[model samples]
Target: MKTYLPQIERRILVRPNQTFGILNYDMDNAYPQRMLELVAQSPTAKDCWNKRAKFIAGNGFEEQTLGKQVINSKGLTMAKLLKAIATDKALFSGFGIHVNYNANFKISSVNYVKFEDIRMGDTDSPETAGKFALYSDWGRKTWKNIMRNKITFLDSYNPDEQIIKEQVITAGGWKNYKGQLYYFNPEVDDYPLIEADSVWEDFETEAGIKIFNNREVTTGFLPSTMLFMQSRREEADNSTDIGSGINTPSQLEKDLGTFQGAKSAQKIIVIEYEDESAKPEFQPYAIQNNDKLFESTERSVEARIIKGFSVPKELINAEKASGLSNGSEKKEAIREFNDNTSPDRMELAEVLEELFSHYCSNINPTNNWKIIPVPANVADDVIGVKAGAAINQLLQSSVPTESKIATLMYAYGFKQAEAEAMCTP
Candidate 1:
């Protein structure tokens, strides 16, 4: 007999694909694809991912021209590209940007490439290999399909003018040349793990819980049962009698199915037997505990998913905390989250700065090229504080210096240091 042990198989395994001349992202070469499907299925994961992306992208670039400059013929602007890169980084911890060069060897335009569509070529050193494979469907194992036209090999992004000129000449012109891809891996890994990878199993579990609940509701929480019917002979119209046997199991199944589902609930079933001692038996399985099927698991999984994304629950759900101080709590959470992710924002800014400075000529590289952070509402901090009225009252009243400082620190949203400095002398 074959024995089975309950366990989950590891999902990540990097291996080289000799036939395709590339390295598989994971065992199946579809890690990003699998993660995308998981996020789509889990509501909490999807929400947390979106929150991270939004926070990472922020409002836009500090330079207004960056937002207005169209990077591609499709009218895609730099702002949109940054947002796309942010989304990819949020999910996969890496992103790809396709750079197109003009006839003069200057970069003409750049576009965002889906991270899942890219695979590193099989090489000892990917940075110097200068080769990458791009395909639309990696999950379908397109490498084995033998369709040479589907897999497009792109040259790695090289800012060297001489190198670009040589590529242009080799292709007979810029028109026939396939564009270069700038694959940015923020983390130092062969393929960077997704940001919420630690909670990926939880995502699947949460999705399973949802499916279980949906099934339970659809079936009206009915308990599964087994029905055993004894076979009996029946006389035929010609007075011929068949050997002891009930209707065929398949036939009985068809009859039983009619009484299944929520619509057939409380319906009665009748069975016939030749002997009273050989009557049919109906055995119901143990009843499910609907009160606590997965309540705790669902909450813990949701919390872990949000935590994995590093987003404050208050930011994800505005109605989570309700009170007079809820606004202040949310505002602080936003500030804290933005501060925590500043390094991530700076990394994206540096990548963009490097790309635009070295390749494009239209934009001024010397300018302050940085992503503008999401603006926090100052009003949120003063949720219950009547700032203007209170300030007027304080100014007009003859309050002591210590009391005034305390009021400023507590009600006017001033730091203790600032309040003490203002009260000094």
Candidate 2:
């Protein structure tokens, strides 16, 4: 069989600003790229993007922390580890895992490999089985590439440990090994190796442009006002023998220097002239008004960016959401969190289920075992309304108090004895 290699150059050529799958010039890149090169990057955009990514990632593990029940398999204990890997990939766009096994065929441990040191190869050729190379540095020096059906244990920190490390090469198939290493590239179609790109990159650029424009406005027009001076007489004359008069150039230079000095010191300027008929008037030029427009533009752009991430505006305390009450805002936030955030968590859970199915089967042979994300809680208002409606219906119906007490005991986790005692009263 012919060994197939992917078109590595094509993948490498994709820029950070371009869309994931398409091979065309990114119009979004033109402005943000220029802003990055010209202005100080907007830390606000960067911070918001980071916070949003982390928020999304954390929402995946709702009500559960590390050491909690994420995955319930005998040999494969990878619930917390999988969550961490998924979070890292969401933040950095890629993540890798190194699967370790003991002398027996069962899996032993699963460790997260740094994304910076792992390079994916031959991605276009799925038939040949893509390669994963782990290196100590970004330069690709002193690296080990794990080819198809082979596992290479890398110890870059200690030279002595490196000498003792064993490289397990399995030729039969991936199924022969107790565990295998895997690299997850979430944005591989959009961005390749040697480039940084994320969902927030465009937002960051838009923010950068706003910041730059504001800076320009402040520096150019905010500090000082333009001064306009008009004089009734153009020429000054003195009674000299041969048209010898006051040097207008020297006098004008002196006046300009005095004006500048007065302006800098914030002092009142008083001009005196020898000619009584030479009348002069001073007027301050009006500053241009674009502050409101700039503010509106910024808000619009920010709104679009927040929408792009499918995040609720209330979560970010957006100003445009002033009409919503605190209670309504809280309800909206919870609804968005449950409806939007849970799907991503479900997709991640599904991926982990497929990857760790082998060990999952060992744990529960009779039934299919899979990883499941804990569901997000519903809004308190909705829950309260439902409970109220149910209580109203029960009161209207002819259900016995004893039956209601028993139902309450079962539904609310109340002790049956206590419920019965309350009913007796």
Candidate 3:
């Protein structure tokens, strides 16, 4: 068992203000009584001693407390001695130190003694150490008092309240539960059982799983896979202030879209322009890392990776798609432009191209340059020439060719405009 000693220390200080006055007189006499009062307030001091008696030679709590052990075993009375040191300030009021108890009793070496013993005066004692520990000791005691009755686990054995309550004391003590006072049954009405500790029900496929509702579910248990449940408690901490970061509106605007699974992590692209009046006005890019949201709008077609790697784990081509061809981000953009609402083919096509073209405008051409939305062969009824042929011939136009290729790349992945350069060449 881990134990803690009262937080106590030993030290010697001589004050020039009251070196040999009434202060010295009080230090030598008035401290022991005050030390007695502090120990008398320890309700659990005796209980702690009973829990660990065989180790020391003494009876009752005081004899076992570090101070008393220091006294009875070593014949030292630092508690009274500490009182002498604090004689001038009533209870050592001006010093930035205090002592207190831990809710969980401790058994360790805690002492408060000065540096040197006076040859012309007298020796130090545990009474003085006790005086110093008194500082934090009292505060710790009160805190422990407030935190004493928390519930850690209640049989919650059967998801049934009746069984949990009947077994509360059996499962041990209640030391960390709070909020709603009931657990409901699994089958039938799900209404809470009055006064029952908790109810067992098969919430997830496992049998006899114990669970709770109403408050936060922070703790859980598994009993031979036969019975399972969780326990929770209200929070008791605070956040610290220490940073200079601030969030802006533009950063959050792109999280408003859906995603495709098989990928994890979402990326939104925002473009900052010294001049937003360019002909294209603005470009949009989005990529999502979700596996459960991929599907077709109306039909499907055979597609292939014409030139680059597959979707990256994260999207990094948004600025390029939005018309900022810096090319440093060479990794294949992991964004997808799935049109679920089945918008008009031309409309969806336009949207997809705008999204990708804006993204590619930022890819690193010499090193990381790439293309995506792998060209697809839709073997269905066509508008004019074969679907594949029409796009092939179209992309075979100019260096900064028609918008179809850009739109197509935007809709799927981003590839460089080297295709347009190829067509014109």
Candidate 4:
């Protein structure tokens, strides 16, 4: 732990669910052990890599049969990808140096806890820092090593609150609240965070830089670094144990099993394309230059956006600033208003009818490109919106700039011709 993490800085996301998870090396600072050879391979990766292995593997997972995918750069399991490069020199040297993707932010960061903390959800009791007990055919060897030697399996519990307060996540049996930390309990979902008592130790932070403000120099982790640190806690319970030896650990990218990773979140869906048309590179027949697209880390990407046609000069941070560490009681924290308003999960029939009727009225059939309320790209906030609520809101907002206007409308809730008309100028 003494060696400074080259291009690595931890990611901390503060979302409505108050979620936080790891966002491994940003592409610019990204270097892969095995895929360094493939660097010249994929230009679409003019973006980044999986940094930590959770690269997915499945039959035709990234298959060409899926259609309209960009250059089919073969994919791999995050674990296999990592295992191959962990020993490669090119991987070490290029620790964090790749071309920038969004270029929205000046600096980027990576996390180390994925290497330091392994977690387990206490089925018996999901309260306090519940420790792991041996419960598998993997033998006692793996258990013994992990307990004392292997990096501690942290629960990956709430860190934002701790980050905000700069206080110990757990003090005795207590979890922290507004001015205090509280303890764990069975009935409470909001309180009693399951935290390991001892804070991670020997974890060192050193300043190293590949480039800074157009020049390379030592610096600190900055930017709105918030990621969904789901930490495979969900995937662990669903995983099928296959490995017998401790060293020959199960690869993070098992052929078809769910693992602890970002895509595991049901809310975060992926719509991966095996062909170029489905890819971000080649514009589809329906797309125009003004349209915008966002990529999800999941195997298949989900469309949850509508970017403004003309770039809005002002960017706003409408995110709730109630603070992540606010230890509110379970009863009080339940969202009273937003009980169930999902935009992502709406029915298309209703949407089509609405749009179809609109077409019969206001649309100009002569031109499809000149229209109001055209689909815009998805924004981060809408991603958190419930499936149905997000969809309806987007159509009504009709913000324009989405790559797929008809499909999102039909799938969620919009009229076909009117929805098309919505896209026409």
Q: Which prediction has the highest lDDT against the true structure?
A: 1
- Candidate 4 residues lying further than 4 Å off, grouped into runs, are 1-109, 112-117, 123-159, 162-425
Candidate 2 clashing pairs? 20-189, 20-190
Model 4 Cα lDDT, one tens digit per residue, 170-275? 4222232112111112223211111110111100000011112212111111122223223344346445446742332233324212422345423332434455
Write one digit per residue (lDDT tens) for candidate 1, span 208-302.
Answer: 99898887666656678887765544322323236754444444455577666677777886755668778768899886675575898888899
Question: What shift in Å separates residue 137 of candidate 2 from its native position after superposition?
Answer: 6.8
TM-score per candidate: 0.75, 0.45, 0.14, 0.15
Clashes of 2: 2
Q: Provide the overall lDDT of each model, using Cα atoms, as 2-decimal numbers.
A: 0.79, 0.45, 0.24, 0.24
Q: What tens-digit string does per-residue lDDT give for candidate 3 at 1-425?
A: 99988965322222221221111212232232233233233222222212112111111122123222232134434333223222211212111111111122211112222211111111143222111111122223335431222311111112234443433334343333211111112222111111101111111111111122111122111111221112112111122224634433222132322221123124343534344342123233444522222222101110111111122212222333322222212222211211211122223223223222322132222221111221112211232234345456556655355575575366323365643453454
Between prediction 1 and prediction 3, which has the larger TM-score? 1
Q: Which has the higher lDDT value, candidate number 1 or candidate number 2?
A: 1
What candidate 2 gets wrong by more than 4 Å, as runs, is: 1-83, 89-95, 114-118, 123-129, 134-167, 170-180, 185-206, 209-290, 318-320, 354-425
In order of lDDT, best first, we have 1, 2, 4, 3
Better of 1 and 3 by lDDT: 1
Q: Who wins the TM-score comparison? A: 1
Listing every candidate in turn, what is its Cα RMSD in Å to the true structure after a full C-alpha superposition?
A: 11.0, 17.3, 35.8, 30.3
Candidate 2 to truth, TM? 0.45
Please list the residue runs of candidate 1 whose C-alpha ends up more than 4 Å from where it truly belongs after superposition.
1-11, 124-128, 141-146, 232-281, 287-293, 358-366, 378-425
How many clashing pairs does model 4 include?
77
